[model samples]
Target: MPTILPALAAGALFGLGLIVSGMANPAKVLAFLDIAGEWDPSLAFVMGGAIPVAALGFALAKRRAAPLCAPAFSPPTKQGLDARLLGGAALFGIGWGLAGFCPGPALASFAFAGWKALLFVAAMLLGMAAFGRLSRPAPGPAPR
Candidate 1:
């Protein structure tokens, strides 16, 4: 209950932020991507506003041993840029450019976006499931 409550609150706050940022609207995102056409620069501003807050959050998180609500901090273990990473990033960019909704905004769009949002979420989940099934990490050398 304790863990779930914090997760829910965070998700709600995130959804609210997405709504306020205009990220929940695919048209706005598409417009931002359309540099040759009617380009909208609001997303850039939103990201600019978020950068400092995110940097501060990361700094504060590093200072703390663990989150106020969590047991321990589990940061990314991998740092190298490999083929699989690059390929996945390319696909993510392609999808974002075509659909104008990444995971967070996509989820937020569900309420107002109707069937197109539902279809996108379904496809996104399918892609994720496929990736999970296909991208098993190579087995390392057996323990000595």
Candidate 2:
């Protein structure tokens, strides 16, 4: 019933699912994105299978007072569409298409994909660090 136990179990299950669903394989993802080439629709099926489970989880979480292992739920605060949101989405899509990773599956793939996976993960972490620095508020008193 420890917090870390559930997290580790969930992460392992997710990695297994990614491997089984072929999401951990860059070739599979690249093929899915290559519409003009040897296109693959299997990734679509993988996503189709995940959406319902994710939606159900969200529905359940919304009804819960607090998570079983957490103090409270902290969902996204930004709801309005903005240039930052759009740009981030575009970056994510581009990264996914180019590297066959969107984080979860990337980390899951590390075991088999080796150094390529490490490079992608390194780049991802670097980008996240850069974004944190760049988006930080200026250290100054509030304007009157």
Candidate 3:
């Protein structure tokens, strides 16, 4: 219950920030990506603003033994990049370029962005499920 409330609060705050920063809007994101035609540098400001805050958060987190909301800091175990990582990143970029919404903003847009956001979210979820199933190791024979 305690963990849920804080997580909810954090998510709400993040969604609010996305909305305020125009990240939840596909048109705005597309415009930002449109370097050849009508590029909007406003989102750059948002990224710039976020980088320092994220850096400070990381620095603070490094000083702490455990996170305030969890038992311990659980960072990514994977260090070096591989084909899976590169392929995943490429797919993510392609999806973002085509749909103008990555997972975070897509989820935020899902509330008020109507049918398009709904479709995107649905497709994203399906893709995630498919990946999970395909990536799972095959079952082996039980030990005697």
Candidate 4:
């Protein structure tokens, strides 16, 4: 199968899941975060539902010879926490507090006509691109 087909299918399914679980609503997420205020524990239930599904997928993948698309599985092996990681985490927390939407939920929230989500996604993409450039190696003289 084509790569685009799998990507599109995955995105469609993820969007549908977000819609069904009411994750596309920033109000719901904000309520969940507001523990001392009008607290909504519904997000916990969403996590509870997703965790098992994710665990099962992981288990199945481990048992498989190879992923259907690739010969080897690509997983992050980074274990050390560095300045870049900490900075990214701080930015993520600030963004979550200010906008009440992370990247996935922000994109999902777009389905519900979220203006903040559109802004958030645009900024997030820009941030990613900027970080990519910032992390690139500097040009230097090659060895003989």
Candidate 5:
């Protein structure tokens, strides 16, 4: 309950940023990805702007033992890349190139992108569910 407000605020801000930065528009993203053709470099500025802010956030986080809204900071436990990581990243890049809609922007576009966003989000959710099911360990015999 205590963390709800912060979480909501962060999500709202992220969604607003996506919309304001033109990330919610598939055409804009597709244009940015089209480097050989009519490329749009505006999103580069957006990414450039985000890099510093994210860096600062990580710097600040490093000074604290625990996050403000949580008892501890849960960072990624993985050390190095493997086949699964590489495969996932390749799939993500391919999806971004083909659809011009990653998860964040896809969700942000949902309000105004209409049926297209709906279809994308639906497919994304289905993919996530399928992955969750497939990635789970197989059940074994009960421990004595």
Candidate 6:
């Protein structure tokens, strides 16, 4: 699809951002999260830089003009904080704290060939697959 190009470009930029911001390193991320122990506040600056650009992009996208590929924007409509959402957030936070690697940073860090990142990515994909299986609809009774 035509949108794939833009998506790839965005992903490349995101990977580049992770690289440039030193987010691709688990030790850097761990240090950032360690407020009481040798903390690094650089991630705040990274978010500060990204937030304005994202805000401007959102503002522009909110205009009536057609989206780049699709006829219109299709943002998620969910607003409620359901159990699954909360549980997922908790799991994500635990994983982040334990592994010091989220999906974005883990993928980007592969360039450095870290075994921990490889394991983290593999486990993350397996968890996603497990969730997909658990979320699937149950089979109905056969017609008599």
Candidate maximizing TM-score: 5
lDDT of each: 0.90, 0.90, 0.90, 0.83, 0.92, 0.88
- Worst lDDT window (10 residues) for model 6? 135-144
Report how far residue 114 has shifted in candidate 1, in Å. Answer: 0.3
How many residue pairs clash per model?
A: 0, 0, 0, 0, 0, 0
Q: Is candidate 1 or candidate 3 better by TM-score?
A: 3
Q: Sorted on TM-score, highest at the top, how do the candidates line up?
A: 5, 3, 6, 1, 2, 4
Best by lDDT: 5
Residue 141 deviation, candidate 2, in Å?
14
For residues 1-144, what per-residue lDDT tens digits would candidate 5 score against the true structure?
A: 989999999899999999999988989999999999999998998899889999999999999999998999989999987999999999999999998999999998878899999999999999999999899887568968
Which is better, 2 or 5, measured by lDDT? 5
Off by over 4 Å in 2: 138-144
TM-score of each: 0.89, 0.88, 0.92, 0.84, 0.93, 0.89
lDDT tens string, model 1, 47-101? Answer: 9988998899899898888898779977899999998889989999999999898
Per-candidate RMSD, Å: 3.8, 3.1, 1.9, 2.6, 1.7, 2.2
Model 2 residue 139 distance off true place after TM-score fit, in angstroms: 6.4
Q: In candidate 6, list every pair of residues with a backbone clash.
A: none
Model 3 agreement with the true structure over 39-121: per-residue lDDT tens digits: 99889988998899989999989888999978988899998989999999999999999978988898898779889888998
Mark the regions of model 6 whose C-alpha exceeds 4 Å error after superposition. 139-144
> Model 5: clashing residue pairs?
none
**lDDT (10s digit) by residue, model 6, range 32-81:** 89999998998888899999999999998888577878787888999988
Report the alpha-carbon TM-score of model 3 versus the true structure: 0.92
Flag regions of model 1 displaced more than 4 Å: 137-144
Residue 82 accuracy (lDDT) in model 5: 98
